[model samples]
Target: MQGEATGGTQTLADLQHWTWVLGRAQQMLLENGIHTMEAAPLSGWSDPSAFARASADFWTDTMKLWQRFLDPDSEGGAGEGEPAEHARDKRFRAPQWRQEPLFDFIRQSYFLIADHILKGVDALPGIDPRQKEQIRFATKSFVDAMSPSNFAATNPLVIERIMETRGENLLKGLQNMLSDMSKGQLTQTDANAFTLGENIAATPGKVVHRTPLYELIHYAPTTPTVAKTPLIIFPPWINRYYILDLSPEKSFVKWAVDQGLSVFVVSWKSADATMGGIGWDDYVEKGQIDAIDTVRNLLKVDSVSVIGYCVAGTALAATLAVLAARGEAAKVASATFFTAQVDFAHSGDLSLFVDDEQLAMIESLNTDGYLDGRFMAATFNLLRGRDLIWSYVTNNYLLGEEYAPFDLLHWNADVTNLPGQWHVDYLRDLYRDNLLVRPGAMRIAGVPIDLSSVKTPAYVQAGREDHIAPPESVWKMTHHLSGPLRFVLAGSGHIAGVVNPPDAQKYQFWTNPGETGSLEAFKVGAKETKGSWWPDWRAWIAAYSGEDVKANGARVPGRGNRKTYGDAPGSYVRQR
Candidate 1:
């Protein structure tokens, strides 16, 4: 009969009347627990304000009832003719409904409630609930189902305390998330405030070095120190270098100096429209390689033990590969990668954001030659949207809370742009294509990358919770490398995994005996221990340094009367 309505024999007026009735009936059924699940989506509005206005008890009960309805075991987990373990089976059948008198009453009450709303809006005629015992029982059951859970597993008391303290914790969480979205739009840093002058007369023995790309700065050993080979540190370009040298007490660089190790850090140049033409190779050539030349020339050293953190470490690996292919691997004495990705093929959750469609959209807009830093930040925040976006929306907008200005928050806001071609090529080739690990899959400056040829002794760190690069993804690099590899699985995410201070409690890492042939064998031989990997890394790096030198090494000629090349912290950082 419904299919025949298409024919002209069925009058258009009758069809319209049927459509109205059906629509109203659906509204009644959906708004109330009729044939559908015990709980349903809120009607009329779907925004946060509507959610806030909703009765707390009503929502709590609705969620609980929905949870139970979804669990098959709640209905014996099986119907007649179903196997004993049917609930665990993928094709398990649901238990049949009993359709008792109480069910009929709830169905009628649902229609009545929906009718009230429709009539109030002049859409339908309202119905009054009958004073029936079954109807009253159904109504009470519905209310009981929706009421907040008091079970210890649910921890309703703790939840209430958090709600009270955090000011509608859910709402506050949402507001913080929205605020993060807005803050992500801006690409300014409130963390890169310290200037060389601030540290300039503070320590006389400190050697402040500046690179063509970055003002390469460091503290040199004043007294006689072990011939510990010069250690060059590389931090991710996504963030400022100070993350490694955060502060006096937490500074990894300061700790290295105390360990009697000579350290030079490649503080990457902040990118701008001028750097739009620069690609991955250019960063290697003008950035890492350039820093190496400057340090060697100034320190008068033949080779340095290089340490690269996160993205910088990946770049270092590429540079080393390029150098090795050209028979120039002797420049590096040893190498250490901190939570870096040489092979991004196994990058789990992050893989979702780098598909073909997203790559195309990014390339089209990045035609300006650079992928704006803000866009990258926004993309990362979206990965954890519930925490970074919705949480803020609930807090600030719904609950009216003040935003906290944390240093990490400020630093997070400081995003740097990536050159268009380079960024796209990296995603498509390394991430989407998994070319880096494939033998000779990548070419740098006309040089093919063969990890087997890279015989540089290496130390690789993998963060357990790192979303950007998982432990497995980074550990995969060891298979491709021909050299001795020591891979450590560290605690924390991408940032904390690398920037970990020496004394941070609860931090742990696993180190195998030597470069245990493969990642699997490495995991077996691995031993877990507490405390940051900073001290362990420092000890490992110190052993790689050649014996102490008698003569003072190369030194950058002082500018003396010449105008300082650039202002403190320089003009390049502000280009964006």
Candidate 2:
């Protein structure tokens, strides 16, 4: 019944729509630079005979497909039930099943014929590149002009599931698919864009120790109690170090010290061959484990609280696991992970790049043993191609617009390369195989990773909109730990989520460990606290800070008269 109504084009509007559809053949050719200018009108469209022939071929095939449902003489009559099922099944056929190769051959042949016609057009005169750019932009605007809502409704690919159905399931699937795709695109756009503070004052404070993976910097309190417990902060090596204590107004470390906690953060060194051979195990051992020993000896503290951010959290998890398995777990007081993951099974979209074939391709490149950071940045960029790739192409080429200068974009564009070996091992072991979550699945320097033995009180944070490590993937760390655990869910992606400062516009969260039945249940009743999660974390540490003893927390010999680096925004940071 429905098929007959659609087949019979009774209204003028229907005929006009079909006419516009046929016109798309010419428009698509124009987008490819054919017939775009008087000097270079599409060569293919140059010959009236050839253009008419191709137009007939395209329209004929399209009508053939359409007539299966719409043309009264071709299919069902007015009283017949819809042929929706057949159409849907046909549309859903895989690319190969759709004879895509043959379609490609036909498309190429049309292009060849079009080129012959365009040659005649090109002989007329040359067009300025600037004008050509405007033409390109105008052509692209046809596709880009649709508002988000209109695109959702009119996009044929999106509306197809509902097009052939009469039941509730059709609406449900359409709604869900639209919602999912919309969120996916939005997340992709957000991930690739961020704002940066301009003319950021660069001054240095504290001395730093450099390792192959990073440089450890410490800003000790000016007036320290005779003895102060040192807090070592391990930031993810993915970006520059200052994010934690960005400035006096928003400095997380400075806030902690005001609460009387000594602080040290690892300023991850930019990549070079000397760092290329470094892998997860190496980072855990030399990067983290050694740092612990150094801080422990330097400060003479029996134990200290350790905080890890993102990838650094993964490193901390492994380090603690190795320590626990070796029966040497007393050096750490507590552990905190900000959006870190121990299990990769639920990693959401990041999993797209982690399958066997991709890993093999990466292995082929990592044969030199270090994954270049540039390669890692490129892979991440591809994941958000609509914004990161197309937006730039549109602005720089199609629109001929000057690249807008922004600090965050500068930082993003200033991508650093990851060592080949580091990435290969990380992807293969953690993401591809989910090794970290497997019982005794991971080993470092002959030590098996048994996270269940890690009794350090733990705090784990996951971001709600995070694409790199979704909440589901990150929260798994709570399940693996043996100690009382706190899991926090923040609002933004990897960086913004963590850097989230407390404001009415934002909120931070927490609840007592095991105060509720499960992570899900606890989240339901968790208290919402305003402002940066950083301050709350500082308070949490103070509560757990061992009683202030008669002696200072920990004392290092080189503490006083130590040379302070230039100031906030040091020399190396400026170099970037």
Candidate 3:
């Protein structure tokens, strides 16, 4: 169950076997300095007493688990909850995990030991907070890898499969592992299932503008009428912007256009060795500001509405801050942030890499002037290792099953490197020093970027379950922005929460129209709505956006003297 029906652990049932599987599927991912927490010495524990108590409890739980294995009907084996009732661990969902006394014991004992060790890790003192976080993250990875469900002997479902396939599954799994090794990356989705501009980034459009840093994609309008103020999205240079235009049914760009708006998206050029000299300022000037001004020229509109998803949202805040410093705050009529973090004080797991020591190590990753994209992709995968990693280990490698086509996973496997200096500047200034939200603490484009100085009307969306950009960190934007703002909480995490479409109606969002003292206070007073936040955003942005005109009007950006560079989902995105 480890979320992705990954098969068994290749008939081996030990830490080393699963570690090999984990390392195989997730090689080159943990090369970043943050994942390199030194194993804590067994003697030098910060809390010796706590460790002693935990060991005692672990043994007590182990003995009690044996009792429950002998008599599984008994209640409270270790501390609480039945094996099947685990809220997070889904690997033991098979009936054999519960019905077979030994498997049940293995499952319960595993959780007990994992929790015990983690509790001990949490209690470890005298370590740097960031180091502690790294240790915790590393510990969790080890614990997750060691789950019995990852082992063929312990996993009844896998044993059943091995028996059914006459051990063909293992052979097939080995071949699959070899294939992934050859590619030097795990195949998270069927490679042949989707194609760019064919099935995925299929929105009809042309690349109206291009820069070395990014391409401005002007999407074809769906409706006859278009907003007087065109909209441009500054997507995180971290991934493809096609996330907003993945497919017609799930495409936020298409949906926005149907609502009578001209939408332009920034397709950032993937960084490589040649792009090493580019820093944060290049993204601000050539990336955001250039794209904003280009859309304005094409549409002949003075003010353009903007949406920044994730890191781009952070960059948008900087762009706005720079504009405010230049007394050009009116350039952007409205701003929308999808899980962007301007304040890293409460940022999630990714923030663990912001330490001074880690910053240097990460900057050293610049092999040709940029950190490799594989580093970013792997780091994110580890953030949700159980689902993104170990599950695939069993399903694709050990279990010998091919994962079906998934647009999201395909996009995820698509890696993008960060400009070396830019990556260092972002983590050091914005994350390590927590400078972005502090007025004048950080300078961008030769100007002090003060988030509060940008008085544009804003709509901020955060995910309740987002780990990459925690709601608490995002909510701090409420206090940072000086403008009238609406904070909306979505039901899912980083990607799903933001990419949610209205038609699917798959997840819900919460709206607290007014400002609150904190994220928790906002949630307490928030009204939960059972649908996508797209419409809610449309209503907020529509007010700022001027009257709609015919989609074919001369005001629209076109194949005119502006020069149609190429089709949307341009050549840059096609760069590996």
Candidate 4:
């Protein structure tokens, strides 16, 4: 039997209510710098046939859905299987969506419309890649905003919650909304459930070195014997370093220390007006390279193994190039990149936001000031709106409940500001121009930096599903380095892939069996490993790590010249 809508008066009221709520979703996009002005689509069709096909498909799908709505039992849509989308899209899996014909139609119709818009954008022809990206972003933003799951009346879950709580859930939701309004971020996890040093960034260590822009933490060795060469980790400044050091089980920092390596984490300071003028050279010199020198000096070693995570890996590649230029490339014993992209040619969705118009707009907003972490976080959240934005909207606000404690999500929320000039210069030079891949096309610290010149052996890894740095983008690193290169792919997205520990036995990883020239070739010849890549990395890195030395009482080695500023996870990470 078909589900019926309420009376005419109730219908009108619902129309007004939903209009206001959806209008708020659009408002959110606006607040996050996705202007509705850009959301206005192209005025003319450059390719008539592509759009013609889209229109035909759209009509065909619409008619099919209409037929299904009229006679749900009719032989239509995979014949008794839930709409193919149900298995894939988690948003409409609720029983009420299928049990009620009216909602079933709404759910199916929304998917059809979303698919039409996105696929239409994909099919749109003759538009330059950049322009097409902008249009696609605009259309996708619109489509994501108009999702039936966003509105109260349209979302059966919200209706179910409202009924169960005797309408008190609505009031609670309103209160949550107002609180989020004041706080200026959508709540993803319980903030109070975590404390930085105690539970999350809890790896025991000391801030052995400090600079205006970063704090270098030296973790005590967990084993009785340690590697002769120290390990310096340069995590992307966009996020705090704690991501690699989440809980003991998930903490890559802890795991590495347990593997008999002396680990040092660089906790970047959240940039502000004073640091706004700081550029890429300043970060490479004072941040990445400085940490290297400090660790080398403390450990009294000629060189150290270095790891860069995410964009920090890009910076490290540049720094290594600079070192190669300065005849100091040998200072770094080995280089490892975690889901990092040195070549931006195949960089994923993140590259979409670094175009000229967007960069100019960002510059205009910055005015020689730092890019706020919240702004960056907002943009990142929009990249996966269904998981990061819409899901939270449904779960927290609509369901009128608090989010569960999640350390990774909390670390994700703890974003760091990008220095203004550094932010613009690199995005323009590396991301937009794709200069990092081209030898001598980019420079750092007054040196013509070339990645290939830095003939240091490298281990580059990418998450198979990473949106920020696609596997193809990371694969291009094999071409950039002059020395030995080992590339690997891990399952899951950016953070999960890298943070995975061996004990968990969670996700799988892949390694090229033989000579791997490209991502596809690697996949074709790859051998799959059953668990985390940490152990594999440990085995790979062991060759580079020097002969083991007896552990020096679980203390940092030879810090004669460097002062111990404080305990591990220093104050820089504590900044918003």
Candidate 5:
């Protein structure tokens, strides 16, 4: 099964081959009573009266569906009546579904059964909570897989395309699937449509310094006069740093440079066996601290503004706390955190996967010293299963269609490995222990971290719909910071909320002047503002940036003791 589907040579027959393989696997599971035991909670007719009532209701619905199917004047089989809101979930959005009654009936019936099965499982006598969660997750996956959208035979869009192209599209889709399999993954984007330095991370800059852990990039100043205080950005090492430098129009790095602030970004290396021993302390010392020192030295500034995104922001906060203890806090002018959480108490769904059992399982599987990037990618996809998983599956497998190239999706697929030590420590100390928010709970570079001691003026932003770092979790940062803090809630989920460029002006943001309270209270007091939050952030950071100096255009790639290591979006970003 591994090598059966060769790239470019896959025919429509390959689809049938995979289907047969799946059917055989299902048969094996059924014959072994896997389904019966897994669904034991729902298998028995424990109460005869309730069972009889359910049977009658099922029969009634089936009769109505049959009547609708036979009625010529019926609105093209629109199910007996409109489906409940859950049945009409966006993932099932196919024109034929609502336009054709049979498909609608099939979808509604599937959801109805799914709801009942889940209810029965929840009511089961004395299941372990962890086991119940695992069971429910598995059940949801099974139900989602059985969706009509996941099968060509049941999907009207796929049927129409097959009839139109005489099955060429099917063959193409098979080749696409085979090609992706050969690469040891599924095709999430049109990879051929993108080249790293050529387009995606095309922002102009130079790598000023390089280390085994990261490369420090100095973006060419877009404005003539730059701020006296340079701005250094630390993006999460989980993915490549290019998300901040995606395209010129949407690039946060570019936006800052245009605002007359000298910008430097840290592009982290993809971890491997060689980097398996790297820990959180190494990230702070060699990764963030080293970059900050280099930027300060180059600009000859006593203090610099810093920005951290996601996990990087958490690392930055810890670093600042360490610096403050050492009386070196003067190096920071102000701190800006984007979708970063210092408190893990409200860290959302991601926390569910970090318990002892799951961590132990992950550790056992990651014997090679690093967590595979694909595993991380899959976990995140599960958080938004309908949009990221099922939708792509339906388009590629069921509809036999090629994915159109999308920049953000491409970036999402370009995942990087995580060092085992760093990953384990992060999960245990932060997610499991909630240490960052606790005074003296964590130590970095020989100094204990207390976020409250770090009194740098702060601006914190969180996405209202962020699942990975819930806004409430981010909101807690205000209480921990000793300095004046301003918190803003942006629209959309994690990535989309932050990547929103000003010109695009797509999402709205909320702000409450001088507001300080719990997240719910803040929400009640905040007023909505139209357009990107970038402008608001720009205005806030400007006051701390100091007056702009005359454009020197002096700092190019190979200046001072720091020689240019390479071009912007350098070698580290190009690493697999």
Candidate 6:
């Protein structure tokens, strides 16, 4: 019955509702007998030897701690109290955690038990590695959910706030949760604080071209004279393209225009049931290729510099390979990739959730032809649970505090759905099979994609702390590209690293003079440079850009053979 419902067109809310219902049914079945059979080895406390070993270790550690506490004259006693080795852990940094010995004792005891339980589970006999991994991930999720820090009753900071507020905060927190639930979503940031065109994607531009797959945006030039070679940006369709054109001050699109470059951005349509048939080929042909053609037609230039971020970079690389095969490689003067992974072997923690079992489950949920954006958002939030999940939980629930409007978090919440076929194709071909880097393994637009054939001088930027596309994975593109490659390692995580503006001057970047085959060798030879990687990118991209020419005045809305669809952001970005 549930499967039948999933097969039809369902809204995110409907899908989530059915998911809950099915999940509960599964839980009930598991609780009866299936869990017992499957998790028999995981129930290690039932084993006498395992229980005894854990108990013995626990007692030994407790007794030693007790002895240390009692003996004033001991080597590290009252006169020289030893600090906890884990004191630096930010999670336990609350004043009450240290001021009250009881809290510390409780915390330490919890860790002790958790450690033993994990060890016992790990030592379980005859369990498959994949099953063991699933068990471990589930255990960690359970442990984290039950953490004292997550609950107002157990958290010291929450208790202090409660005492100060005289319980008013708790009521407010309940109200906030109820409000968010009413909207059928989780609250990450104060959504009410942001308006799309007015604040976020406010850069002046016009939607000069539109297709079923995307809207081609030509941003108004900021300089009297612009570079002859136009710059076309292909952003990941999984999220709104506004991330690059965020706010005027931090807008890469605006900055590029200011630098005397004609900037064109492709805004991908949020997928729906109508777009179910849209596959990887459609994205390349009707999406990137179409946008490139629009830019070329509008600017009347044969060659254009290109920029791609995250998944878009992967698609763009394939598009270039196809173009190169067709003898149209000169259409792209140079290419820039921001935190994009061409080689999936080192794709980081995101890979853990992409196994056969998980993919099958995902396929079931995507039976309606599109994966819900909210579902994708939840998966990403899990990647950094401490920052994206529990922190928000504590702020909105325990403290009853509303989130301050943050631009990046706001953009993150503004997600777009993926066509079912495209999503599965990406997971199967690139991630599961690791085929993108392999020549003749995959074909796009009827041409065999070979990354080695893509010899356009490339600029690749990877965030050192990026958990999604790890720097090592992004660096692998250097080995595949036959052209001159410059790889820069930026400080901070994925989004922040790419969005770093020169005026903000927050994160630094590392650069090596030349590309090396080995990622480790590149890192060793790289030198640290202060400030945003944007400047370095601009300089490199400009090198490939042709000489400055009189700026072609901004195209009038709905002018020429290709009429403007709407405003800069277009109708697609406002879908959700």
Measured by lDDT, the strongest candidate is 4
Task: Output the lDDT of residue 434, model 6.
Answer: 93
Error of 3 at 296 (Å): 1.3
What are the lDDT figures for the candidates, one per model?
0.59, 0.58, 0.79, 0.79, 0.78, 0.78
How far out, in Å, is residue 404 in model 5? Answer: 1.1
For model 5 the local lDDT of residue 378 reads 87
- Measured with C-alpha atoms, the lDDT of residue 158 in candidate 6 is 79
Q: Could you arrange the candidates by lDDT from highest to lowest?
A: 4, 3, 5, 6, 1, 2
Write down the worst ten-residue block by lDDT for model 2: 146-155
Q: How close is candidate 6 to the true structure, as a TM-score?
A: 0.86
State every prediction's TM-score relative to the real structure.
Answer: 0.65, 0.62, 0.90, 0.90, 0.86, 0.86
lDDT of 1 at 54: 30
**Model 2 TM-score, 2 decimals:** 0.62
Backbone clash pairs for candidate 6 read: none
Which portions of model 1 miss their true places by more than 4 Å? Answer: 1-212, 220-228, 514-521, 549-575
Tell me the tens digit of each residue's lDDT in model 5 across 449-483. 89889898999999999988999999989889898
Instruction: Please list the Cα RMSD from the true structure of every candidate, rounded to 1 decimal place.
Output: 16.2, 16.8, 5.9, 5.0, 6.7, 10.0
- Candidate 2 contains a number of clashing pairs equal to 30
Candidate 2 residue-wise lDDT at 24: 70
Candidate 1, overall lDDT? 0.59
Off by over 4 Å in 3: 1-47, 72-88, 126-128, 555-559
Ranking by TM-score: 4, 3, 6, 5, 1, 2
Worst 10 residues of 3 by lDDT: 25-34
Model 6 stretches astray by more than 4 angstroms: 1-55, 65-88, 110-136, 554-561
Candidate 1 vs candidate 5: the lDDT winner is 5
**Residue 238 CA error for candidate 1 (Å)?**
2.3
lDDT of 6 by residue, 296-367 (tens): 877678888999999999998998899999999998999999899889987877777888888898888887
